[model samples]
Target: MLNLKQIVAGYGPAQVLHGVSLDVPRGRVSALLGANGAGKTTLMRVLAGLVRPQSGSVEHEGREITALPAPRRVGLGIAMSPEGRMVFPTLTVEENLQLGAIHARARRGYRERREEMYALFPRLAERRRQTAGSMSGGEQQMLAIARALMARPDVLLLDEPTLGLAPVMVKQIFEVVQRLKEGGLTMFIAEQNVRQTLEIADHAYVLENGRVQLEGSGAALINDAGVRRAYLGM
Candidate 1:
């Protein structure tokens, strides 16, 4: 489980997140839903230790990690599959995954973890020696998620996993998420794709202007009149 309390973060002087607070329960999917510029990515970055909060705390299973660096967070069993599927374009799929396990904490069972990733996304196994740049967007997204899993993280942060893909690919990505959920992976996701995201999320927070505008169970949000009107356009 991870807890972020009153997180205040921003780039340089202009603040982006304003006292944002949320929780990611163990073995459950927590979603952050909002339009662009709603501070969703910023919040994820803070949790990943890429962006340190100006004020507040980040606790992983009751261990405060607010000041830890990104690599330290990875060592602490937190992994992030960034938005836009930022795979190493020039590296082979295997090579990219290898880098993910470079940290000492993830190195011990590297082979086993790699194999698990392959099993989760067989396309990755087929393209083990292929350059990442040559893969399709959907394949690249899968590669990104697989690469993160190589670290054997306890909590996974996914930022816009379905950003710019075909509808079919989106469904595949969601399926992967469902599978991860069933496997008891603690995931915190930031997404613009509301309907599908809420369907899979156990709990969700709706963000607006660097703050939580609403927070509730995903199923409840699905039937929420305001959520339907604003994000789903129902």
Candidate 2:
């Protein structure tokens, strides 16, 4: 449902993504696997409209969205769960999620969507009034995902949702990802855990040195010689 073509982007003058082209087919989980500094996060931000591309095009469903601002992107059904969770530490979980629906177009039925988020994340229902910072890392990550879901997104961008979590938490988060996939959510996930990401994704792209090095079906990528040598460590 989303297509990025030659996405050249960076912070200020240092370009971090070079001709990074990939496609996220509708209702499928697309994983971008890479080590640190591979521009995975940069690519996610570009899709979210948080970072502008120097020269490239971003399209959703067939139309170009290269120049839309972040809110417009949200309005257009794109939501991001950032790498660090980025939950408002001072605010309650429900408040944080509610704030996410404040985009101009979402004011109507905001309360209804908030209830939907709580339903999707039952654990969030119990902790709705608790401060985000008081929650565990995994819970904070859930809050991030829940907050993004509050926007009622058609596509979700997940950036390192398992970073620094315990093994059990990682499994739980991946389970949530699986559930979302089964329920037909389109997602682009930038992840360090190649095995887990590949397991959940339909297709995968390997990013190296700020560019796409290889792309294929997730299972195929898991067995690729170069990917095994560098990423899977086989």
| Per-model TM against the reference | 0.98, 0.96
Candidate 2, residues 129-171, lDDT tens digits: the string is 9999999999999999988887888999999999999999899
Instruction: Give the C-alpha miss distance for residue 115 in model 2, angstroms.
Output: 3.2
lDDT of 1 by residue, 74-136 (tens): 988999999888999999999999998998888998999999889889999999999999999
lDDT of model number 1: 0.94
Candidate 1 — which residues are off by over 4 angstroms? none
* Backbone clashes, each candidate: 0, 0
Backbone clashes in model 2, listed as residue pairs = none
Model 2 misplaced stretches (Cα beyond 4 Å): none
